[model samples]
Target chain A: MDNFSFQNPTKLIFGEGQIAKIANEIPKDKKVLVIYGGGSIKRNGVYEQISAALEGHQWSEFSGIEPNPSFHTALKAVEQIKAEGVEYLLAVGGGSVADATKFIAAAACFDGDPWSILSEGARIRAALPLAVVLTLPATGSESNPNGVMTNYETQEKLAFYGRQLFPKFAVLDPTLTYSLPAKQVANGIVDAYVHTVEQYLTYPVGADLQDRFAEGILRTLVDNGPKALSEPKNYTVRANVMLSATMALNGLIGSGVPQDWATHFIGHELTALHGLDHGQTLAVILPAVMAEKREQKHEKLLQYAKEVWNISSGTESDRIDRAIDETRAFFESLGIATRLSDYGVTEQDIPAMIAALSEHKMTALGEHGDITPEVSAAILKRCL
Target chain B: MDNFSFQNPTKLIFGEGQIAKIANEIPKDKKVLVIYGGGSIKRNGVYEQISAALEGHQWSEFSGIEPNPSFHTALKAVEQIKAEGVEYLLAVGGGSVADATKFIAAAACFDGDPWSILSEGARIRAALPLAVVLTLPATGSESNPNGVMTNYETQEKLAFYGRQLFPKFAVLDPTLTYSLPAKQVANGIVDAYVHTVEQYLTYPVGADLQDRFAEGILRTLVDNGPKALSEPKNYTVRANVMLSATMALNGLIGSGVPQDWATHFIGHELTALHGLDHGQTLAVILPAVMAEKREQKHEKLLQYAKEVWNISSGTESDRIDRAIDETRAFFESLGIATRLSDYGVTEQDIPAMIAALSEHKMTALGEHGDITPEVSAAILKRCL
Candidate 1:
């Protein structure tokens, strides 16, 4: 295992009715700023639950954070935060809302232009404290400090992270997700699965416990992701999926381990260019990357096949292919298109995505930092 | 899964040469108090590393924290903290020393009798900040806020926990454990294994991630634990073992799951009465406890039999018995006898141990609180 230092201080309040805990988690004296995407919370019971929990608390609301939260909109929230002097942020929807809240929190407190914090890798010295009422379980942003936001004008997607943005508390009531659409649930499952693979399926790091933890998240998603879609109201299935997503990217599985995030970096390019949902981009790109870089990640791919896919009897190359096939199939089963053509993308589009990678200086990616723009183009071509 | 809230804030600095980070982790202005066990760190060259790190920092030293960490001895450290007004503590040895430092950190700021805090469940409202240089891998007290210390005068062992008592940082330099005796290595393995099983081998609670995490820790220990004894200097093996022990009881596995620490509760009694090592007591008693509660814990036992021990080809009763047998055999292979009689704990010692349980009010233990004193006695009788 490599040398690493880790510390995550997000307190998770998880169960059926943990939303009511917002009353206790947030400070009584603080003026709260609640953030969410669209009006889903209002359509569901989450808004009413938050209203009831923070009944008399002094607070304001910022709606329409949007999926794949954009900085153009989050800047507005940051402006409101500064104008109203919002002391605390309550992110009350899915990961995008939480991501927006984190972005706003950082921007509100940043001494300089906060856009540079994402685009230029600026340091976040301090940010407003935030707590989460996670109605969506796609991104583990509720617990993790890092979040990705898009720049609509530049059509660029980027991520920013610091110790300052970790939620002070995260309330995960799986029942709140019962009202979510089947598509969103499927997206969540794929999102979490890819997150686990990003941290895992890289190299043998002697991080046995971390490997098991990563696989455990994968297995949990494989077993319950479909069940969550089929029976949205099943508390047990939703609870497992919800918890797995939180654990997937909460920094536990990646600690002291060699994590390959080539898929995510490449997938972000696709998301930026094609406006695909984050998980759909992942579903389109990961198998191609896995196939292209099979030799570099051969041993772990075999382990993933035997342990996660239960395909131990095949030849090495065959097992890797089967694992990738099973992965694409899993995403397809969720009503997602794993091939670029299925999503209406052609081989002609590969160069532009590869150019975007070059503009972003994405020459070195993955655990070995060898996923050059050429390699990325090859992976994208295979996706076609 | 049950409703649960969880948070652990201990910064884990893990790898070789991490000891030098103490200067950065602790406050520069605070007068530090360094604590450790009987000169082992000194002999292992850990002392030189710690001393070099504390070169420019103002610090005092306290030594001689025993194996189980005596509260009476820790009280003296509390007196020194009060006298010197030590603002922070640095525990440089194993879990016992860290446990003692926790006691001292809590007791120094405590208002009422500190013993009442242990025996009377006095609330801990404040504590001095502390960091650890962990030389042992048995107890996960480094990452967790809980600690167990023996009251030597009362012949009682008790645990104290509060959010305030968590270490600010824990430096896990795997090389520090390289000098440990083979016996200590075996004990660390058993201690970590039982800790995982205590949280795992009760009943399935829909906590698939947690169960897999527990099994992951168990599998790591099973695979590399013996290698830690044989090839003491193997960094990969020791790192896996060290990391496994920390993760085993750091609340990740136990979260939202009904944990069965009845074995630990019963095992502590044997430690207090017969002076056996904590891990030895666990090894001696856990198989018997599994046997005794086979009916109540049937489902989880079957799962454990298949997943952990791979003993699936038998009748339900036979598989459970075989699982228990495999557990005992694993401990025995560690060169630690798995029966109480081998440790000179005969059936005659059962009555006094039962009295200890009654004295400690451990009448109801296990996940379902079904391990009554009578049930515990029966388990002990079988161990004999």
Candidate 2:
């Protein structure tokens, strides 16, 4: 296995009525900014629970952090935080709000233009301590030190990572997910499944234990995800999905191994240009990326075929084909479209996406670092 | 799943030559106390590597922490640490040294008699920061907050847990295990396997994902352990075992689940009384414990049978029996004796061991709060 240093200090408070724990987790003396998206929390009673939990704490609310968590919208929250001298941030909605709050937390402490942090991918030195009341189980932004931010003007989305911004505490109540729309639930499952695959389907670096753990999370998602969609009120299914999403990308599976995040990097362009949901874009791109990178990731693909998809008894090429097909099938099973055309994207948008990828001098994508811009275009063409 | 809060903050630095990186992990300004067992490290070049890494650091060495880590021996190290005003501790050997250093770190800052902290099971309020260069893969003391300390005077061993005493860092190099004896390697595998089983093999409790993770760790240990023993220098096998041991008991598998550590608690008594190795005692006790608690833990036993041993085509009773038998056989395959008679323990020791367990009043020994003292004694009798 490769050399690695790992430390995640996020304290996860999980189960029913955990939202009431907010008052104890955060200091009452600090000025807190509770961030959210739209007014879903109000209709779902999460807002009332959070407010009752806040009690005498010095806090205010910042609403309307959009679905994709755009830099343009997050900067407004940062401005309010700076103006109010907020010392802590509590994100109380879905992954988008949590992801935006992460940017707001960093931007509140950053000296330069906040947009530069995303565009230039600058190292973050310090940020206001952030906590979350996670009502959504996608993105894993609650426990991990990663957040994807979009620039609306440039029509671009990018990810930023720093050790300073991991949540101090996250309260996950699976029952809070009972009120979520079915589409959002399906999107969360697909998002979490792809997260596990992105970490696991790459070449194995003799990290057998980590590989098994990655596969375990993958299998759990596939087996339990359909049940979660049908029975939204099933506490066990929601709890399993919540835990699986947290474990999927919380730096546990990626330890001591090379990671191929090219699918995510490519999918961001689809979200940026076509305005597709983040999880839906991944459903469109992952299978095509796997098919294109099959030669380099052949052995791991075969293993994934047998272990995750149960596609044994085939030649290597046939196994890779079946594995990619199984992946697309799994996403489709979640009611997510696996083709760009299925989502109403035309062939006209493909050239612009390809140009954006090539403009970045995209030459390395998979585990072997060999996915070029032409190969990316080929993958996208297959998706079309 | 049950309500749970989980957090582990130990920074794991894993790979070859990671010991050299210890200089940067610890604070140079703090007065450090280096603790270890016998002089095996000195003969194996680990001591030299640590010495070189200690350049320009204020540090002192306290050697001779024995196996099982007695309170009598740990008191001496505590005294020296207090005299030197040590601000941090560095444990450089196996789990015994690391476990001993945890007590030393707590006891140095503790008021009143240090043994009171163990005997009274009082909450530890503060402790000096501790780090480790783990040369053993058996007990997961390097990454967890729990430690077992023996009272040599009473022939008693007890476990104490405190949140304040987790290690600040742990350096794990699988290459460090290459020179270990064959018996130590076998013991390490059994120790890790039992750790996983203790957390698993309980009632399902809606923790399907945790069950899968626990089973994955068990499968990895069974698959890679023999390869590690036969080819001692095989990096992949050693790395897999090291990572498996860490994942097995680092609170990852136990979260949101009912854990039955009755076998570990009982195994400690056999070790303290008979001078048998901790892992060997566990091998002897676990199968008998399974047999004794089969009725209460029937559902989980069937799950374990189907998942780990793959005995699906049998009656429930037959499957439980086969699973228990297979567990004993796996331990024997590691060259461990799975019966008390194989270790030369006679019938006279059984009543005294039962008395010790009764004194502790461990009423809730198994998953369903079963495994009374009488049941524990019956399990011991079966082992004989």
Top-scoring candidate (TM-score): 1
lDDT per residue (tens digit) for residues A1-384 in model 1: 999998999999999888888898888999999888889889888888899999778999999887878899999998888899899999988888888898888899899888899989999998999989998898899999998888888877788998999999999999999988888889889989999999998989888878888988999899888889888888889999999999999988899888888888888888778878878998988999899999999999999998889899968999999999999999998888999998789989999998988998888988898898988988999998
lDDT tens readout by residue for model 1, B19-132: 999889887899999999899777778888888998888999999999879988999999998889899999988889888899899999999899988897789999999888
Best by DockQ: 1
**Which prediction has the highest lDDT against the true structure?**
1
| Pairs that collide, model 2 | none
Please compute DockQ, using alpha carbons, for every candidate against the native two-chain complex: 0.88, 0.86
Task: Count clashing pairs, candidate 2.
Answer: 0
C-alpha lDDT values of all predictions:
0.89, 0.87
Candidate 2 residue spans exceeding 4 A from truth:
A314-317, A346-348
Per-residue lDDT of B20 in model 2 = 91
